[model samples]
Target: VCSPEYWVRHVREAVRFADGVRALEAQGVSRFVEVGPDGVLTAMARECLTAEEPSAPVLVPVLRKDRPETRVLTTALAELHVHGVPVDWERLFAGRDARRVELPTYAFQRERYWLEALTSFASDVTAVGLIPPTHPLLGAAVELPDADGFLFT
Candidate 1:
């Protein structure tokens, strides 16, 4: 069901997602992975593909309803890898002794006035924006340098 806020905010751009998918398709973006609570946009995305694409782009989901989380994720990752997406294998192995290599070239360092401007970089707000309460993952948001966007978790 659509909410009143959604009707107001998104009715103007009801085809936004499908249009975005078409744009990506035009740019030769064939692989799509919807990393959400479940597979919501897969069908709509598939529908957006054009016949000129040679083949419909591979679409995968990270989550599914009534399915084991780990199993679904692993299968999706494997499918993506098979379809030529370069996922970092190192992400699967955590807390292991990671080997580091030193660079042969010397490094250059530069100082910034902004670094000394505030005790906490997070406190400085260059812009303020509101994420609607009806937003899927972000119920609210405040940009911070300490973290990427908001912590929906």
Candidate 2:
């Protein structure tokens, strides 16, 4: 590949592109990352992989034509991450103020965002068939032993 004759032959002779992909697939390589100005080979790689295999390889393009470079690269990284690729986040965000946030453990489900306001039960707890909590701010009214005496929190 480094020789001048190889380059000349590469241009003059037919290139075994699919054969190279097949060879890599034979070696148990199931991930292909294309580092180029544009994702020209990605589509070709996908076509080559679809014809032969038990599993299709994940094709990732680091840079895409007519797209933001950072967004394309980030999306590629996210795809790789979803495919179980181990990324060194510490090194990736060495100089950036990136922080790890706690994600929801449960699967997020689609829910209605615009809901009608709930009727206020704070005005009267008994209306909801519930007793008020015995907190310092609010508590159930208690009758004192003496007449015309009531305790309130």
Evaluated with TM-score, which candidate comes out highest?
A: 2
- For model 2, how does the per-residue alpha-carbon lDDT over 1-153 read when each residue is reduced to its tens digit? 799999999999999999999888778889899998998998798777744553457888888776678767877887888888988877887888998888667666675445464578656666654456568686556434212245665
- Steric collisions counted per model: 0, 0
Model 2: CA > 4 A from native? 1-12, 50-55, 107-153
- Name the TM-score of candidate 1: 0.50
Candidate 2 global TM-score = 0.60
What TM-score, over all chains together, does every model reach?
0.50, 0.60
What tens-digit string does per-residue lDDT give for candidate 1 at 1-153?
378977777666555787888899888788999988888788678887885654558888788776679867877887888888887757774676865566535444463334244544343333224333446554455433222245332
- In angstroms, the error of model 2 at 144 is 68
Q: Residue 31 in candidate 1 has what lDDT?
A: 90
